[model samples]
Target chain A: MNVDLIDLGNESRNAGSFVSFLDQICARFELDHAAYAGTNPVASAVHGYVNYPDAWKHHYAENGLHRIDPTLLVASRSIAPVDWSRLDHTEGFEKTFRDARDFGITNRGLTIPVRGPYGDIGMLSVTRDCSVTEWEKLSRQILPDLQSVAVHVHDTVMRSDVLSRALRYPALSTREREILQWIAAGKSQQDVGDILGISHRTVEVHLRSGREKLYALTTPQAVGRAIMLGLIYPL
Target chain B: MIIIVDALNKDRFGDLLDEMFKLRARVFGDRLGWEVEITNGREIDQFDRLDPAYVIGLDDEGHVVSCVRALQTTGPHMLSDVFQVLLDGEPPLRSATLWESTRFCVDTQRLCRDGNTMKAVSMATCELMIGSLEYARRSGISDIITVIDPVVNRVLKRSDNAPYDYVGSTKQMGKVPAMAALLDCTEERINRVRAFAGITHDVFANEDTVRDLLDARQLAFAAQLGESSEWMAAILSGSEEALPPVLPEDIQDYCRAQIETAQTEEEHAAALRLVAVLVRERVHPAMHRLVFQS
Candidate 1:
């Protein structure tokens, strides 16, 4: 796997080639499936290729499972690789996994999170169906190599033209942009509303929409993005 | 102040890291004449994409004065990949407790301009050394194998933080000779470096101090841009989480992410504040499940 990673630079040129790379990885490691998902920092859209069964992929997309998939939700937030067995079997996890089992997917898996300097996050998850002890030993042995692979895959994908072209900046409305600018200038929502002669609730609405458009999970993040995108100028 | 920037907090210190990278470009690509890739005034390579921990020193005004890169030896590192020639014929050392320290540099030009050139450079260098060693020691790293030139080697020895041994014989690389030297992450070593620099207080900056400095800088920038003073005053008096209320689930998810990625003591405190907010919002069930389950 380490040797393969050395040549990953030449192989993974686009999403299609990356899928083939994942297939080769699954075959070499004797894993059932290998999946990679990453949030494109510029576009703020999720993009990647997975080697899961077609039906399961379709089901996952139809259900918007990425938002609640424990493998992604939990792992993407972590700096360390997360073992599937350690995840909490919450309602979302139960729904996702129970359906996954129907597709002949094992609940046993490992997800390695890779973070880029630009705040982009990539997750490489691999699952192998086997006895508990065998799974544990295999995961333990391959953890380091898997971590390297995750970084390689993420850097390659980030450099790919496919992702670069997908850099669609979300268009914020005039009001949204104005509110974000005020926020970036250190104005609170109430102050912004009072300055703009709008109700505070209306100010909140615009800020919420601005955050959604920016794909920012927090207001500070939204303000940061707005400033970076030049929608708001702090200086 | 020396700060350790890793995958989790890299976003918070992006500008600082950029300054460090630009310093690397000046030192490695220009000064040292090494064949390093320099793009947009930043010297960043594939290893940097792997999220290596960076021990960076910042002056009172938050300029990157010194920096070093640390990558685990258990995976691909400069010694195993880029500088294999320095390893002779022996296989690269790979161990969970070992890390490779490379790209160690100081902004001698900037430091020298501040005070006595030699004193400033040595102080920043020793501060960075102590910072990396203490950080590595806390993170359970036992040893560090660093690639450095003879000049840095001499400085290390003079500071009493000399490498305990050498990995391979020195070889001429680019304009200078380079060697791989080994250093143990021990209390005595940190103490020696601290003593040499006459640094008694903690080298690592308090998180709140860092945050306040950054905020002040931002506010100053805004003021310089002609932002209304009233708005700046309001921000100054505003609570930390003064943004519009997000959904409970969103808050919970954000808090969970914060908790999972928290590394430093102050980061944990911030995460705890998020948990407290979640509890106050009556979103205890989901937060409770996420917290206790993990």
Candidate 2:
């Protein structure tokens, strides 16, 4: 399992031979199914290759089954390796459990979750048609590697934008950004004062302070610079 | 080096925590008018001890700045009681692997706001978050969930316009005119309207209303629907009932993705990458991504 985990990370970061490398790991781990789920938190765009039937994905997306997908419940919050057995079974879940079984996802599974700055989350799941004993064996054997691979990949995914922006723009404190954003929104000193509950003069001071820090000539220029640098976007 | 001092265990951190609290009061309380007693001028909370914390900003000598506290989940916390309401009947996340990054107070006296040093502080905070994610990465921690005020929530919720890395449920609890925002909505637009942050009065008019943000609120799902329908859908939209991705995993990916794509005239991207590397080196492993870097 540990070797398998190493292989997975090596494959994901290779940037070449990606698919085959991943497929080999998937097969070595005896995983009946695997997926790389990328979520857009803003759009609620949860896209991944679940071993579930295509019908299920379609239904989940079209009919919004994600709204009721209890598996996601734990996936959304848990920060560790989770065994499907630990899930809180929905009443009558076993009655229709065959739906998941047909898709090879019901046998037994483990989920390795990862999170980054600003609360982004991702998961690496391995499922197989093994008995509880076998599943437990697999989970224990690979949990470390699962965590490692998930973490590394998740880290890489988040830093993908570095080539675009400069190096020094995101260093301001929360309060500074809070004040700058208010001013950038076309708010007058008095208006900014009202929003943040500070004196208009204080708003003036913050704006001036930001202007001096950014080395901009005017208030509007400072606002433009902040926006360009992703410093103070609209709230 | 960032330190996480406990606001509740004031005696432990002593002067630093006291000074931190006073700064908070001056910046948030006196500024925002939450109206708490500010004997020395600082706003403290119970949850300060319940999560792994850090005052990871900067000092004035043009040097890197930070403070680490002892407000970890294994310790005391304000949310266990005051914010337990948000969890309701469900077993929402509250664990060690999943730390709630708390209490970001900078020593303004130590920080130099000249030459984009403010950018340095912001990047440092982002770095701390990224580091926390890395720490969680090695462990079994699956998420990094925390309660945010309306202002922070609104900024992140304007997902349609602003690029914030978060996904969760937003419920309107309590009752009419007093409903709580559960953060379950993905449409980054139309986030819950918040009261004034720096305020003693409600002089802030209702500028951006429910109507303006509804579409942004439902942004995640808007692509699949019609334009007008997307806007109309979010306001009346029901819950995803689906769980949000674990906070740590979600954030890590989001921040990395953002770092990869961020563009700016200043050095925001370098700061972002540097911070990302530092976060991966220091903080817990996580899934949250921060796109706020330029």
Candidate 3:
């Protein structure tokens, strides 16, 4: 597709633009297919030049793998990009993993699990079928950049400001705004507080206020609203 | 890091549409066993322009693949306030959540379509549905409803429960499968669903309305202001071409096995050989041309 990376770099790191840029990247990598799915109530989905079977996706969703979505769950808990193969498959992942593999998921894959300031959990992943040597080389070579790219695209598509837009409120103080922003970016209260030099309680207060203003009943909802509003970026 | 969402610029709409078309042709061709229509590339609907398609998901290359194609029903769609007869005399327009997630398609032909991800109409649709609920919930939209094909509606029903109660019935929509409606799309109904289905909430249609809409053909209705009440019958049941759904348990495993085995090659190597043989045979005469190029 010959897209300008700088343009993608400019977009807030969210799932949308990440999907877009990935399309270009897939072309660059000479790959044929890809997809990006956000873990939300509505569970929005994005697609790359490649596509997957519906029966498979339906099976995955119908089976409710998000609870045990090892990649998504683990990625949510960390800021590092993980190789799909490196994840622990010892327990609670037989069906999901089997299904993923049967569907031709690359044993050699990378998922940059991103946690924003407010506990917004997302993953930027890349998959490919390659020899063990080639896989190792690609992981060592592209893993670092892939993590950053995943974060960037994740933050861009879901650009924060989801708070006010959700509840019809004005923007909050930059610090608090930044906190909500981080929250939408997928960071936890302790993390957000630590980043802003505030107590977890204080972070809670800011989030509570933001949550109230956004009229969100749950933390995930609050983060979702914040992302929709452009109040935060997944950097 | 935080992720932000902004509507795509108008300039990029064409770029997006082209992608949508190609994706649809790819997926529908393989998954549903349907023909492809890419003359001008693909089909464009009235809703495509009015609604901003929201695509979210990661591609295999760790990039974003946005599938944004839908329109909120603020005015009228489907039954069009036009040459339409109301199954419900007054058209059940109450405080309900209803929206048509229409012409949903995704490209599945290329790129080893992901099993975890939705491709073609399915993925595009799932993406739209997921994002729409999140967006609508945040936007304080309560009622949400959609009238979809029966097979598609069954998929929705199986996945999660909606807030408002809905009514559904199969209709002779032609083709391999019949069409049906899943009613009960109210914000309140969706909220209940969110609580129970343990997912985000989105309103869907009311079941009674759905039934009334389909069964209206059986009821008596006044043609004009002073016209006699015309007693109608056999609206939903009139069609002779539509096949009825069998109980899942009732579906013959042996028949399915036969089809699977028939397609097998390598001198009857079971399902695997059958599918492989089918792929080889079809490709040689058909799929082969499409696939060999790859």
Best-fitting candidate, scored by DockQ: 2
Q: Rank candidates by TM-score, best first.
A: 1, 2, 3
Q: Against the correct fold, how does model 3 do in TM-score? A: 0.29
Model 3 chain B weakest 10-residue run by lDDT: B225-234
DockQ per candidate: 0.01, 0.02, 0.01
Indicate the residue-level lDDT of A53 in model 1.
88
The TM-score leader among the candidates is 1
i-RMSD per candidate, Å: 21.0, 16.0, 18.1
Better of 2 and 3 by DockQ: 2
lDDT of 2 by residue, A72-171 (tens): 5445444345566645365323433446655445637766655433335666666678788877777665554455455444433333344311321334
lDDT of 1 by residue, B14-105 (tens): 87787788889989998999888998768999999876888999888777889999876545678877787886755555444457899999
lDDT of each: 0.73, 0.43, 0.42
Ranking by DockQ: 2, 3, 1
Model 2 is docked with a DockQ of 0.02
